[model samples]
Target: MPNSTKRGRRILAAGARTIGRGIVRTVTRSDAGAHWARVGGDWYETLGELKGAAMKLGQLASQYHDVLPPELSKQLARLQADAAPLPWERIREVLDGQWSAHQWQLIAEIEHAPLASASIGQVHVATLRDGRKVAVKVRYPGVAAAMDADINNLGRMLRMAGILPFDGDSLKAVLEEVRERMAEEMDYQREREHL
Candidate 1:
């Protein structure tokens, strides 16, 4: 019923489809690894598209190169790359909530498309009234609130796949650290002070 649940279900369905397709394909002796690679690739692609905690989990999984096979780590590492961007209309709503009419007047132009997208946010190019260009990072709506659920869903999915390299305690610790970092990243004032 929750948004994260919906996303998790969608990811599971996609995985099921990938496995089904792979099973239907004639498996040669040497193609077994290729089959797993395709499935892993699909899993990482879904995680990348989901972003949020899902992408974070992929990033963490990628770090277990010492424990996992090199090929698996290499495939999962791709999840660390940029994710798909949010639409301009959604970004506009976020800006509307953050800025009043008087504050908005200070920005002369904001590009509809984002310059880059990360797990939790995206950056856009904006021109100030005085013609100074700046990068504005916008957080995805409700991502902070949904962080825990996303992590839980991703962990469950990975465990179910029998591909989790870390033990439960280690996974918990890593996820806690990630949550803290995500919170810090969302704090624009903190970042400004640091800068």
Candidate 2:
């Protein structure tokens, strides 16, 4: 993979505040289940679009059935399977940089649409020259370089929004864990070796 051309993320305070207000409203409403469902959907959509630390944390948090409201967790679980995919154009040019001419020749075809998408990458179905099907995982253009910025900005935004219910130091500790996990994820070589 070549160095990324994309820039780091910056969370807007106003946006975070808006999301926070919605959450507060949901919690206070009589129709708590309905409101939680809506909040979860909104969260899944928003975090999926962000495609970085935000989405990663959303996915992680969605799994806590005991911790989060059931309605919210149900919607949030979609992040693991159905998060929005990046367009093929967003990653196609970088394919050349990822492989040599001869290596590229071994690929018979690669589908434009992703099979699945997550915080750091998307998976595409591909065919090799030998006619075997394979899955290709493509990292987003800037996700590796932007991980730290994404984490910091997300932590600040979530805190300001009152989403995480943590003090600064506690949130800092959690974000640090996310950073370490994402850092490991960014190293495809290490992942491949483990596989």
Candidate 3:
């Protein structure tokens, strides 16, 4: 088979495995003399679990709704903002790391629960001591580490599955991009400065 064909098959297999294992339900279709299987589920959570390239793929799939079954498209559309909020304790811990106890006390009120949660962070509504309302964004627990592991594993998996062309220069460029992004993301202080 051609390299592109092999790569396409590998991508499909990876996507199928990801969908099958994540929050999905199996659907069956039957004709007068034939049967077929379909899969459907919470696209958002499935994409979130896949993360990185897989999540990007899901988003891309959503764009081509005419080519995808309704169930698949609907699920992928749901992924636009599908995630559970992190617990309040986790939020507090992150805040504690960023603020002193006195500083926390200066905040008149902070929502115990997050107002919203996404793959990387959660947002909380807070009132400062001066009676100013603010929104706090707390990065999810170990997200940087998880992202690193996921990216590295995905790269290895792509290489092993022959999904990535074996070009050393291309791979080096990819790794450099990953490293730059990861480094920036891992620095809370830098993020604060950027904000």
- lDDT string for model 1 (1-195, tens) is 137767868666655655474556555344656665776687677777777767777787788878865666788888778577889998899889988999899999999999998878899999999999999989887677777777776656554555656677877787778787777877877887898
Q: Relative to the unseen true structure, what is the Cα RMSD of model 1?
A: 3.3
The residue-by-residue lDDT of candidate 2 on 1-195, one tens digit each, is 122222222344334544765767767765777767876777776667677666787787776667677887887788887767777877786686787999789999999988887788888999999999998888887677767776776676667666555688987888999989998887888888898
Best of the candidates, lDDT: 1
Clashes of each: 0, 0, 1
Which model is ahead, 1 or 2, in terms of lDDT? Answer: 1
CA lDDT scores, all candidates in order? 0.75, 0.73, 0.56
- Model 1 clash pairs? none
Compose the digit string of candidate 3's lDDT tens values, residues 1-195: 113333334445554554443323224333311111133353355446544433443454455467555556666665556656667886787778878878878888888878886545767999999989998877765565455445554455435533234466665567556656656655767888988
Q: Candidate 2: give the clashing pairs.
A: none
The runs of at least 3 residues in candidate 1 whose Cα sits more than 4 Å from the true structure, single-residue gaps closed, are: 11-30
Ranking by lDDT: 1, 2, 3
Ranking by TM-score: 1, 2, 3
